[model samples]
Target: MAVIHRAELRPTKLELLAAWLPGRRWYQGHADADVVRVAAYRFDDPAGAVGIETMLVSAGDGPVHQVPLTYRDAPLDGGDDWLIGTVEHSVLGQRWVYDACGDPVYVAALAGVILTGGGQAEEFLEVDGRLEPRETPTLVSGSGSEGADVPGISEILRVIEDDPTLVVTDSVQLAVVRRLDGGNRLPGAALTGTWNGQPNPMPLAYVSTR
Candidate 1:
């Protein structure tokens, strides 16, 4: 399970993305356009040491983009290239945010989900002395094998593309959907998700190598 914190974040997520997204090679937003978060989902770290989230955002009415982020208490070694900048958390103090694709924890969690056909992480918020379920606007699931060797590398598709098929093999461990489309169709083994705007579950990405 993932805990939904009620703490504030200095600079805010959008504020950071607004400045960072324009510089990304895969960002499709107009240079001057404003961006907004459309949907999001999370995956739990079994050790509970990191926070992982996939944010679906849009600039104006343009295509939705996926930005997977990982939050940590300290800088990730050898992940300087993937750093998305850091933020000050009201409750957690300073946090280092990085592109989830480059984080080992995020990569492993994603691979495990695909291999086990697992669903998105369950979330709970602390209310007035009680733990209340937090509702997510999206539904996500993964499909793959559980008995294969874990892949050592993972590539994240940042730009949104219009492909409904995923090609995979035992040697190649994963294929991530760069952009999601209207069609609810997908080919071969993969991960799928459905949100408010897109009711039908569509392929999000693919994972293999157990």
Candidate 2:
């Protein structure tokens, strides 16, 4: 396991969002919009290098969008724009804040971590070196694939939909639900996840990559 450094005494999950939400493409608002975190969860890349989270923030609109996030100690080599902004945790007492999903390190770690289980795997290479991956089903959900539930991962992937049937992989467990308002993708967002099974046993969303 790599030694991942995280600031201690981090802000409330909601407070983090107050600071983080304005920077997302999925986020709909002007430069000065108020964001309210409806809910959130925490997770770690399988390799433990990337700290991950999925948050559902309400822009005060009727729609709550899924905002997948990752956190890192340093700036991603190719992701200066994806970074929302960095801040020293008022509680954690450290500096250097960044959105992890924008970083190649987090995406690569997520890819490996997500497919941690199964007798088989569907390999995906990130697009443009971002997280935009060609997701082909490696193991159908319910294949008894097990992985570490790094706390808020389910909270992150969930909330986008309310489904009783959840999708599980070696790394992630997600539930297939359609985007109610047809959530839009980021301009730089480039990735796809494919589930290989008869009749497509998992819900695959059109996560567009520009």
Candidate 3:
């Protein structure tokens, strides 16, 4: 389970994404467009050291984008290229945020989820020293079944950003859907999700053998 804090964030997640999204080749919105959160989900880090969250956001009236992010207390070694920016957390202090495509932890977690038909992490909000179960705004599930073998992904060999972002690993290639405009028909073990407006499940990512 992932714990949620009531603390405030300086230069909120949307604020940071608004500045970074335009730089990506697949981004279809204007540079100064207003980015708004649509829905979000989380994956738990087994070691509980990193916070993994995937957010679905829309830029003005444009297409929704899937942006997976990881939060850490310190900088990721040799990950300067993927660093989105840092934010000050009222409870966690300073946080180093990076695009999840470049984080090895996220890659492994995502692979495991896709291969094992796992779902997003359960969330609990910390309030006055008590943990309260919180309902996730979005729900996601994988296509593979439980007990399926999941390969270990030690590194991200390459990240190609297009309509769908591809992360190349030693064992498999992960295709992360960038724009949530529908009509994604990739074959392989995949992850799909549903949000408020989007009641039907849509493809979020898929894993293909290398």
**Which candidate number has the best lDDT?**
3
RMSD of each: 4.3, 14.1, 0.8
Please list the residue runs of candidate 1 whose C-alpha ends up more than 4 Å from where it truly belongs after superposition: 145-172, 182-188
Candidate 3 lDDT tens digits, 51-162: 9999999997789999999999999998999999999999999999999998988988998898899999999999999999999769899999999988877778998877
Measured against the true structure, the TM-scores of the candidates, in listed sequence, are: 0.83, 0.45, 0.98
Per-residue accuracy of model 2 over 20-63 as CA lDDT, tens digit each: 66554344555455666554333445665555654555665545
Give me the displacement of residue 164 in model 1, in angstroms: 12
> If the candidates were sorted by their lDDT against the true structure, best first, what order would they fall in?
3, 1, 2
Ranked by lDDT, the better of candidates 2 and 3 is 3
- By TM-score, how accurate is candidate 2? 0.45
- Backbone clash pairs for candidate 1 read 160-179, 161-179
lDDT (C-alpha) at residue 127 in model 2: 42
Using TM-score as the measure, what is the rank order of every candidate, best first? 3, 1, 2
Per-residue CA lDDT of candidate 1, range 1-210, in tens? 988778899879988888887786657768778879888889999899999998888887667877778999999988897798999999789999987766767777777777677878999997766789998889888766556445554443342222322333333444555445443444446778889988877777765453
